[model samples]
Target chain A: MKLTIQNLTYSINDTVIVSDVGLNIKKGEFVGLIGPNGCGKSTLLKNIYRVLSPDAGSIYLDETDIRTMKSKELARKMSVMIQENNVEFDMNVLDMVLLGRYAHKKMLGNMTPEDYEIARKALEEVGMAEYEERSFLSLSGGEKQRILIARVLAQQTDFIILDEPTNHLDIQYQFQIMDILKSQDATVFSSVHDLNIAGYYCDRIIVMKKGRIIHCGAPEEVLTSQIIDELYHIRSEIRENKYTGRKQVYYIPNSANISTCAVTENL
Target chain B: MAAAGFAAMIAAMLLGSVGIQPDWVVKILANHLSRHNIFSPEWEANKEAIIWTLRAPRVVMAYVTGAGLSLCGILMQALTKNSLADPYVLGISSGASSGAVAVICYGWFRFAGAYHIMFGATLGAILAIVIAMKVSSVSNKVTATQLVLAGIAVQAMFSAITNAILYSSTTTSDKLRSAMHWMVGSLASASWNTTVYVLIISLVCTVIIRLFHTELDVLMLGDDTASTLGINLRQVKIGVIVLCTALTGSIVSIGGVIGFVGLLVPHITRSIVGSAHKRLIPASVLTGGFFVVICDMLARILAAPEELPIGVITSFFGAPFFLFLIRKSRNSFGGKNG
Candidate 1:
């Protein structure tokens, strides 16, 4: 399904963190949001996922205004995976994944065999099917993230949102995560930090600075050396990847390190 | 666990200040329940009064309070999303006692007749929760240390309120003594009347909480995950708060502030049953009942003929356990702590 937002503004303690941002992702497109640290990319994703309500704006999933939907109803349409927060308790891995079927089950309903099958298939997709009975807290960070993706997959929504899904993973695991996300048949919006990864996976890249959407277009069009310098303030080279012929950004952190964004913002 | 609780209750009835024969204890209970002598009374006449008239209801009160406290602990843990959360540790019981004292000191809420203390205690429980949560939740997340410290603050504040009411308003020594029961927690005054009321309230709350076993499990994954997984976060949290207050209110009105049963029983049971609430709830309730009954039995015989407050017994076990838990889980959530 298509996703839309209009005039979404979110602030904290009278300071605007996300200011009057508007954007959309057409059906089945993989859209990546990229920006400097603390640019409110995560916050904007939160607004769309209903974790943080926008201060003065609207988000729509297709024709439906998100505000009009029940939390459960909204969850059925779009699933979200944020940075892993520590859990105080541990459950079996399969049970954690089966949490996705909650919206499909009644309040007093029992999980049917079909629910287990869905969870198992999602686990298989994430290469976690063998770890189904292991303690959730026992997994390594990257493995835990994969299991989380399993949960998202089990949710089976056509729309998905991820907030920095590969923040602390090693290079190979990071690409593996991006690969898994790209392979899903869903309208995906994710906050991504690696410019090369974004260029490789995203159909469109939305650039943000100071909580506002500054640019949006096909990755090849948007990842110009000028725009990279514009958004990040550091020097970077944009060139075609040898294998894929896609736009790739190679960072030269030492070159032209200066800000022209006209704001003294926290990074 | 249920059978163990039953056995412990019977053992408690047999072991009080006076040891009534186990055979007579059974006969006394059977006769009382069927409203006739189920078996011929072959024991001393006063033993019947000791087993049926007095000890039976008292053990039942201990059973209910123990189970109630355990349920409150489970609910509070889920509510705060912190395992360390419990009614007594979080000062909910003290707040409840403050309400019970206010009612006792001035005979407030007399319009509600027999249920006045329950209402007052319920309000007090709610106020305590609000204060504790308000202080503990400076960050959106309530960590183990923050929750415990906030509970201590709320506990101290409400304890002072209870004492202030007891000191200022009580004109007679009798009022002071009865209100003291509400402070330290005792089943000494538990009769069929108060026992029945507490049992019913605790049962209702327990049933309601048990129904949310799945929701509680989901909530452990934290608020954002829980909400996205079809939990109406506000509604579930409110339901937990309301029921916990009601349960704490009634138990405090009748038995005073029983400390740590909620915290101790749930932890021990969780270790055995794992974290699934379907198994945890029933097992913890039964274990809580047995734990308290045993504790009360010790409270009775250890000071034979002069009973210790049930809180003294539970705190003896709970306070150190609480400290140990803190030391163990100090680094469980690390961003907030050094």
Candidate 2:
């Protein structure tokens, strides 16, 4: 499915949070949305997922305008793993995952054997199959994030939008979650903070600054020292690691900057 | 299950009051159905009066009120997503009491008959709900705390009104006794007509609620989640509230303010069946009916001729159980972390 976000503008009161942002995600591609804090990555993603309506322009899932689609129907196509979900009630983990099947099931319809099978497979994919009977609130943060990913997998959507899915996860879990998304061959659009993880996982990257797309291209093209400095106002260096033969990027603290150093060579 | 409940209530009808034998009770029921005044029988005269006029209606009323309150409790709990919520949490019962107090004090009885009592009670309940809704809707999201606080405020206001009228009336003693009888909660006035009325409303409302149990389950997860799942939050919330208030109004009209049944039964049902409303709801209705019947039976047997208030019986049973359930829920939810 092609996901196209067209010329979107969003504002809260008079403050423009996301301005004239757009992206075209082809079928089965892994894309990252990276930006500094307060640059409206979450706001832009929220608009695409229909959590926040854009002040202007539109999102299209292929030819279907997302704003016109029923929320349930849209949910069936694009599942989301957002930050900040807390449950005050205790629900069994399996039951929580089963709730993902809700959009597919009719209001009064009982879950079929197939639905249970799909949920079980999704749980197994996240290696949380054995935790099905455990209380959802008992899981650690990383375990909970995995369970949430499993739930979205059960949602059976070809497109997944994750807003900071690795927010509180340890390094191992961060990779594990990204790996699961990578293996799924699903169209994965994520807002990521850790630049290294974004470098390793994303096929293409979109960089935003103050609600506008500052750069958009393959990870290597967009992860330039100049664009990084412009977006974050920090001096940085991007280089290829000789031993690993992978792109390596690191930042230098402000106190270490030299007056004679070139912008790209300072790190 | 409905059959079992009906059968249990029938069995309860045999166990209480002055010496109406099981065979005689059955004959009275049958013969009464055949259009004869069972009171005309050559059987024991005192027994006939006791069976016909007193015990039977009381039992029926107890059952009706019990089922109605429990059903409303379950619905309101689901609606508000607060376990502490009940039909009275909207101050409807206090409003009903205020209206009933007015009728009893003003001697509107001669003109109003039962209509004045039922109408006044219903009007009071409706007014209380309107106020609760008003207070909560000042902000778009109605938090559990807001609803409870509004309920407390309205309840206090209505209680003051009831008290003011009680103190000033020349007929204070008589009105106070009747109001106390209503407040303490009773099935003392149950008759065939009243039983029929309670049955129709409770049954219809219960069925209607059961049909929407799935929607109720979705709504309990909070509005944003429910809306994402394709259920319109505003319409469903209003509709359920109206339905619950209607059932509550009916119960208050007949039985006055029976406390804790609504608050207690849903939690009990949740523990038994988990939080799935499809199972919890019907289970709540049956369990609620059974609880009221048992409590009513106990009320009849414990004090015999004097007749204890059904509310007294429920609170007696429900209060300690409430404390225990709260403790258990606190443990299950792992204390304040949520």
Q: Pick the TM-score winner.
A: 1
The segments of candidate 1 whose C-alpha lies over 4 angstroms from its true place after superposition are: A255-267, B332-338
Span of 10 residues, lowest total lDDT, candidate 2 chain A = A83-92
In order, the Cα lDDT scores of the candidates are: 0.86, 0.76
The residue pairs found clashing in candidate 1 are none
lDDT of 1 by residue, A1-267 (tens): 999899999999999999999998899999999999999998888788887888798988999998889878888888888766568777778988998888777777777899999999999998889999898888888988998999899889999989889989899889989999999999999999888889999999999999988999999989988898888766666778889989877666654454533122321
In model 2, residue pairs whose N, Cα or C atoms come closer than 3 Å (at least 3 residues apart or on different chains), thus clashing, are: B57-B190
Per-residue CA lDDT of model 2 for A80-152, tens digit only, reads 8875353444557777677778778875577788889988999999999999988776899998888888888
DockQ of each: 0.56, 0.26
Leading candidate by DockQ: 1
Candidate 1 residues B8-49, lDDT tens each?
Answer: 999999996666778788878988899987798898888887
Q: How well is candidate 2 docked (DockQ)?
A: 0.26
